[model samples]
Target: MGFLQRLGSAFSAIIAFLVGVITLVSLLLGGNPGLFGDLPQAADLAALLALPAAVLLRLVALVIALGVLIGIANLLLTHAQRLMRGRALSAALLGSFALTLFWYVARAGDTSLLEAVQLPIESSLAALLCLTLVGGAARVIAKRADIWSLLFVLSLLIVLLASLPWAELEPLRAWRDWLLRVPVSAGTRALLLGIALATVVAGVRIALGQDRAYRG
Candidate 1:
């Protein structure tokens, strides 16, 4: 676990450094493209900056996808430890089939294969999630029957109302939009600002030689 933590921290630092360098270069190019005659035009500089940005974004996405897959595999292995051999095999086969179906749909791109599998997979997942949520709500209501359960029911009702036909649910739609655009947006901005501030603080500490965890 310590090794994994160190590895994750190192990987995060590398990603941060790359992003910082790319952002600095993009700013320099955008601000003064003539400095690099190879990309003198605004469009050329933009394109040059965009290429690395896109590549970095894709790299991050690939890393996240791989991490999720690894986590799921680990979870399955852990659960398989206690299951009967036949049940374990069935679980593994079902998991692999679902993952393969998702992968194929993702890459199918305008093919009939996507059309054939996408809807069923989506519907099944949605149904499963709904059932899980309903069961959880029932348990919570039975166990506590308090404000939290009331809040959950209210939130679910709001979501259902928001999903109705726009003409019939204009008020609920407006309320949802307001909730998202105002409170949610404000909270998101605050969280991002906090992250930026923390990053700056960490950078300052490292540069001042105050952070020694990275040394050993």
Candidate 2:
């Protein structure tokens, strides 16, 4: 760590430690003393966690929800195009399929009533950037009998089908629950453990001014 960086980090650590101690003390003393007062109850709160949208507001609500989908496609297409330029067709196709699939899973988090949406003006523009790339990649990989991407895309298609309107995807929904309850549940616990360990290490390193990330 550089001298100035160490100095700044030390200052931040001292301030943060003091603030945290003060917060705990305030809570124990039976009074809210922070800048913010009471937090909203979970039952009273809107379904949006990642969205700052107030569902009571008609237009703002629509914009924030739709904006999540639009922003995801825009960010993903940029990287997919770069992969396409490198003629990494497998990577490109897999990237597109994965990006769409993950975003679908996340945005659909607990909302079961609505069909997944794709805006023509936005989706067409986004798909145009990568679908052709995926096609070209598909052809090239076919010659080598490479079916990794082909398989992934097909699996993603099945997942999409499971989410579609006409499909009695109740079975898929059950499978989704199982996926979370079985592997995903365990994996998340493991990931949290990993994150906790990393946090402790990072905290120690920062306190000792050995973290390069904090130096900046």
On TM-score, the leading prediction is 1
Query: Relative to the unseen true structure, what is the C-alpha lDDT of residue 195 in candidate 2, on a scale of 0 to 100?
Result: 100
The C-alpha lDDT values of all candidates are: 0.71, 0.59
What's every prediction's RMSD, in angstroms? 8.4, 15.4
Off by over 4 Å in 1: 1-119, 137-153, 166-173, 191-216
Cα miss at 145, model 2 (Å)? 8.4
Count of steric clashes across candidates, in order: 0, 0
lDDT of 1 by residue, 156-211 (tens): 67767898887978889888787778866898899999999999888655534456
Clashing pairs in 1: none
Collision count of model 1: 0
- Stretches > 4 Å off in candidate 2: 1-158, 212-216
